[model samples]
Target: MNLKLKEKIRESLSAVLPITGIVLMISIFLIPMELGTIVMFLTGAIMLIVGMGFFQLGAEMSMTPIGEGVGVQISKLKKLITVLLTGLIMGIIITISEPDLQILANQVPSVPNMVLIITVALGVGLFLALALVRIRYKISLSVLLIICYAALILTSFFVPKEFLAVAFDSGGVTTGPMTVPFIMAVGVGLASVRSDKNSADDSFGLVALSSIGPILAVLILGCFYKPTQAAYVLEDVETVVTTQDVARIFARGLPLYAREVLIALLPIIVVFFIFQMLTGRYHKWQIRRIMIGFIYTYIGLVLFLCGANVGFAPVGAYLGKQLAELSFNWILLPLGALIGYYIVKAEPAIQVLNHQVETVTNGAISVKMMDHCMSIGVAASVALAMLRVLTGVSIHWFVIPGYFIALVLSRFVPDIFIGIAFDSGGVASGPMTSTFLLPLSIGVCEALGGNLMTDAFGVVALVALTPLIAIQLMGLVYKLKTGKGTPTERAVIADDCDMIVDLEEDE
Candidate 1:
């Protein structure tokens, strides 16, 4: 209704149309897509567009401000123990609600669903505390990452071969739609309370750190559990006979998601309500507007999930199976690369992150630049994912080297770039990667007689890993040209209010 909301919608549409058009053209050419399937794709696309619009609006209205408020309050508390506890609790709560984690948990055959969820949550909670401590003490993110990864590599050897890929993939999926906006905003909020120049840079590593929790936890799970069975059960689908049937189906599905999104959002809502009661930070008018925005978010998430899970997943699985069954299975590499490029553009959280990165860097890091970096990274990751299925390469071979390069590059990039790079890694792998890409990979792996847990499971992890190097490489280039030092000493520079403005005006 308002100008800002309209602009957000415009941005969402900009992202959706290109992918929709490309997919449509390709479907018409490559496959004998039926009318019903076409309708399903359109329904999913519309849901994605509207979902992005609503989710972004809700994040702006509710998550960002609330996270920033919480960050300020937590900083004022000034006690290291309290700050660490707050971070840990929030991490657990947020990761538990993560939709991406659920997507992953359902696919894993070895661990009990609740056990996997709790393990992942605990992992996130522990690392989130470490992230908070890093912010509090102004630790070098690169050094911490190196040390943490050293532990990851050492742990990998003891873990079973089949579970390793899934374990790494969990790192990427754990920071999904529900987690990204809140955690990133929390970083921004916390960074805002400090005068550190690197505060903006520091804000990004939260998503990066939170991703680490699941990898470690899942790896630990693998040590004790052997994944003997591949969980690739085909979901039941009732073919809709007509347009009205599709409408009825969506309507029936809507309420289920409405309930789920509301439940997912309840913790943050309650936290905000309590914060408002105590601090009275917002006026009545502001609360009314935010509540309305939250309603849109709830509706948006419901449609988005219903459409994606019901409409998109089966299609992805079918396509991957069809393609892999062909003599030309290797063709999945370039085709997947093209899809990965376009699909990353469609990820809801990526738009928010792209805008944030452009802002934080004062247009020094443009959205187009970020998009280009992510596109290339995703393109490469998807290709690798396809390759993994065809060749059955170990995930550690790719991930260890990929992370090693990313960690080493972190030392050379500007502090802001370091933060943004890690954040980009998480944002690049959002809901779409888990829902579509993971299924696609699994289908292909199943068709190819590859180990599902090992071959298909690390697609999300690869998606998350590549961006760290890509974005940091972008930063390295920027620094080489501009000669800016890593913002280590100026991590807490006072009075750089332009950070907020920079994010807001991103083109």
Candidate 2:
């Protein structure tokens, strides 16, 4: 276990170092931030590396086992209502536990936090159950995505303009690092019960369908709830003066996030205990391991969130404001693009999703491919978001067409890629995007005196949007390279007896 954690930390270091380097370079040459602030950022980066290491290991042990156990048991049930209800209840509980959703809820000032959280939770529960039904019935993922997105698009017209960005953003934010692994493990468990050729493909779409719930839920809420756009304010971050000041900041911050992570993780623990009570699924030793995994998860998240919120966020905001105020402010466009290019790699959930994809697809979609594709997709999205900040362009201008293209491409790509693409969209926009990139955009928008709701927001939505198209396009290239229904396709997603096959896009 120690060796495994060391490996995870090493991998995390590789993932995080590039973005950390970029920030250091920018601080030294471009922004020239206060030494104390730079020290805080460095501290946060260290926390991130260690936290991510522990989080990944913990998730694999805890979330994976519990979710898979639940999924397998649920799939074995003879009655449909029991399965659906189980899915619904599980969805609601897990989503309510999501720190990301809680973060997003606080961002919307007009709507009550509990109200928005419940609404979004209900949406996830319903859609997650729907996703299960789709898998059970062997329904085409493309058709369902098209229908749901169309409803979401039509619903947007009745929504107030200010709420649009927030609504779209809710979709991305709800599927952050905390939720993706468990939700996906359930899908894997559910699919493992089946012997059909399509189970692997079906397993990939749960996150995709689960992502749509927040958008639809928030958009519907927008129709009735009128928000006061100008009332939205960016919270001011406190300045650090000395080494003790940075230590004091983290010392104070850790407990707050520790409480938050505890609250977020409690429901899951209760559910697991209930599951054990009813199912007697695990051996005593297995139960002990899971409980330990939970502890690791708890500690990891507290550190990760504290570093991100207390350390990275203020620096991101300050940098954006400073850069946008520059005489050569046009540099914001390129600089944003460049930072975004590397930042997506640092998202902890991206590692989970990449590993999951490779495992489920039997290496058909390599981690290297997923990494490059995600990076490029996110780069483009952030560039476009920076443009929106500079010019105050409508989100629908990018989103509507982007989704349209993604949906259109879905028809042409392999069935597996459609699910992978949409899932990537959600995974790409993880906690990092929320805590750092969102604030950066807000800072730029604040500096330019743009509508914060309209211009500054939706960075997350864009982050979630482009990967849908970018990944499916990679699938298109894969299709051309490996033709339809070829050995690569079949072998990549085969049973245990099949050998692992590699399909490269040549980077």
- Please, what is the TM-score per model? 0.92, 0.94
lDDT of every predicted structure (CA atoms): 0.80, 0.87
On residues 275-313, what C-alpha lDDT tens digit does candidate 1 reach at each position? 899888889998887787677677667777887776777
Best candidate according to TM-score: 2
Return the clash pairs for model 1, or none.
195-492, 195-493, 196-491, 196-492, 196-493, 197-491, 197-493, 198-491, 359-502, 359-503
**Candidate 1 global TM-score:** 0.92
Mark the regions of model 2 whose C-alpha exceeds 4 Å error after superposition.
230-237, 485-506
Writing each residue's lDDT as its tens digit, candidate 2 over 1-507 gives: 589889988988988889889889988888897777788999999999889888988898899999889889988888779778987898899899988887888888589989999999999999988988888788999999999999999999899999999889889989977789888899899889899888888888888999999889999999988888644345555678888888898999999889888999999999999999999999999999999889988888888888888888888888889889999988888888888888898898899889999999999888988998898789999999999999988998999999998998888788999999999998888899988899899899989999998889899999999989878877776775566656655444343212112334233
- Candidate 1 worst ten-residue window by lDDT: 489-498
Candidate 1 positional error at 127, Å: 1.3
